[model samples]
Target: MIEESGRVVSIEEGAVWVETLRRSTCSACSANAGCGQGLMEKLGVGQRRGYVRALTDLQLAVGDGVVIGIREDLLLRSSLQVYLLPLLGLFAGAMLAQWLALPEAFVILLALGGFFAVWWRVRGCSRRGVDDPAMQPVVLRAQLAVCAMPVEDR
Candidate 1:
């Protein structure tokens, strides 16, 4: 399970909206100095909060902290759907155009068309998966609040 800690932002009938900080490891990469991605991270390009509607049975309040998780297999499948599908579409389109002996410009255009078509299909699938319990993250448990007071004060 891939787990993340987040704070509950809102409550619904059977779920809670949790807000988590989107974290990256770009700073730890050895190529950070020469990587455009590392520079982009330095510029805060992808730093943002992520909101997830996690299904939960625990009684949660808006300020409560919780740990949420999704299955590793689900994450892997989603990754493949987002990345491999488009590449396959592009290759298929290019192969078909080449086999037909189409002009170079037409081949590029057809490839792009195929890529966009598959991307559109993937977007639709993601939308439909929004309500799928198997795809959605689940609240694993609520985080216990730490006491701010010193032990001597007790």
Candidate 2:
């Protein structure tokens, strides 16, 4: 399970809306100083904050801090859907276009068309909730200011 801390924004019966900081991994690598990812991070190219609708069993309230978790398997599958399929489509489309001896411009267009076609299908499948339960995040536990352990034992 992958976990992150978030603060509850709203409660709706069985779920809670939480807002968390969108962490960037660019800084973790030694090559970040000259990498395109580091440049994008410096420019704030992506979202700074992220929202999650997490299923919860606890009595959570607005403004409460909580830990949300997502299954690693689900994350892996989602990564593939977002990254791999389109790549395969691009290669297949390019090869088909070459085999047919199409013009250079048409080849590029067909490749892009193939990528978008697969992307559109992925979007539709997600909207139809093909694997929502596995993809959805779940609230793990409430965050506490202090741990239950006694202090000054050292």
Candidate 3:
């Protein structure tokens, strides 16, 4: 259950809009006073980005915690369509071209297309966390702490 928080920017016609915050952990840095990462977070403070999604039958308020995701079946189908099929197509095309004495240019183009197709799909899929309005990783695991608490001597 990934989670991210946002202020509902709008609700209209079976859709919800939200303005989200980027997740950065500059506050805990030991050198925050001189760190570039800390500076960026501070400079970008209070900035908001918008996300819009079709409202589902489930009741959701404008300010609700909206966790969106690619459903498991959708993900599975995408993996097959985007990755495996493209690879198989490329290999089969390359071999068939060799066997049938097809032009080298034709074979190269098909193989390149297949490779690009897979590259594009993988890039988008991995960044689902950045672009998807519904899926948030923060809700799943943010607070399993490390290190022991300090003891107060009596």
Candidate 4:
């Protein structure tokens, strides 16, 4: 499971809005200084705050802290869906256009058409609830003080 802790910014209809600090991998690497990512970081673009919505079982309220997790399998599937589908669509369109000996402009348009088609298909699937459950992040545990107290200490 991939997990992150965030403060509960709001709670509504069984969903919790969590605000978390976003960190970049560039900061940890030695080559950060010369890289684009590092340059952005140096320009005060690092450590931005981001928010996520998590489906929760616990009764949570605003100002609460919580831990949320995405299952590994779900994460993998989502990653593939978001990244691979577009690439596949672009390649397929390019290949078909090439086979037809289409003009350069037409080829570019076809490629973009393929990419957008896949994007639209994915959106339709999302609306149809094909991957809804797997895509949603789950609230793993409430970060209440009581829960954090060790048994021995308690």
Candidate 5:
């Protein structure tokens, strides 16, 4: 359950739209004068993004920073789908090629080419900040982590 904070920019029933800040610790570091991180941060201004999500708590409002987690099950399932689905497609295509008496080398090359093309497309989407939708029943792990902390710490 990775969590990051954003400003609650708006709200609707069971939802809060938030704008996440592009936070880089390098911005405030004394060594920023010598670091590439600061240089990239400066170049990547406006990297911040907005996303709307369901909120059980109605008390939160605009201008308030809220933390959100990319749901774990959704993350895991999406990774599996991205990695495995194309491989399955390649296998099916290869089987057809084999039955059609295509040369073994050609079949193998087809599988490899298909795999690379799919992987490349998925990578491009990920790099562009395109989000995969979450499966239902998102259990909030970060909230549970906070609750499970010992009483003395609280």
Candidate 6:
């Protein structure tokens, strides 16, 4: 499971809206110099806020800290669907156009058409998955709070 800590911002019937700060480890990575992500981070694109609607049965309130998670398999499947499927469609369309001895303009047009078609299919699939429990993030647990000693106690 991929987990992230966030603060609950709101509550719904069966869900909690959590706000999280996005963090990056690119600075600590040895390949930061060679990574495009690192470059993006250097350009001040790393830190940002994100909101997630996570399913939970626990009684939580606004400002309560919690941990939320999603399955690794689900994440992997989504990544492939978002990135690889359209790429495959593009290659398939280009190859088919070439096989048929189509003109350059036709090949480009078919490739773009294939990419958009697969993208549209992916959008539909994502919309349907929104209602699937397996696709939703689950609240793992409440975040632990730390206690500090007062000046008098210390």
How does each model score on lDDT? 0.94, 0.88, 0.59, 0.85, 0.65, 0.95
Q: Which stretches of candidate 3 lie over 4 Å from their true place?
A: 1-7, 18-54, 58-61, 113-154
How well is each residue in 1-154 modelled by candidate 5, as lDDT tens digits?
Answer: 6566666677766667766666778878999988887888888863667564644444665666566766776678778868886787688668867888899998997777767777777777666654333432221322212336555753
Question: How do the candidates rank by lDDT, highest first?
Answer: 6, 1, 2, 4, 5, 3
Q: Which ten residues in a row have the lowest lDDT in candidate 2?
A: 126-135
Per-prediction TM-score: 0.88, 0.82, 0.42, 0.82, 0.50, 0.90
Highest-TM-score candidate: 6
Per-candidate RMSD vs. true structure? Answer: 2.3, 4.0, 10.3, 4.8, 10.2, 2.1
Tens digits of per-residue lDDT for model 6, 40-85: 9999888899999999999999999999999999999999999999
Q: Candidate 4 — what's its lDDT?
A: 0.85
TM-score of 4: 0.82
TM-score result, candidate 1: 0.88
Model 2: how far residue 137 lies from native, Å: 0.4
- Best-to-worst order by TM-score is 6, 1, 2, 4, 5, 3
What is the lDDT for 144 in model 1? Answer: 94
Which run of 10 residues does model 3 get worst, by summed lDDT?
A: 136-145
Candidate 5 global Cα RMSD: 10.2
**Predicted structure 2, TM vs. truth:** 0.82
User: How would you encode candidate 3's per-residue C-alpha lDDT over 38-131 as one tens digit per residue?
Assistant: 8878898635575645334444555665544335655565568667866876786677676778799978877777567666766677677554
Clashes of 3: 3
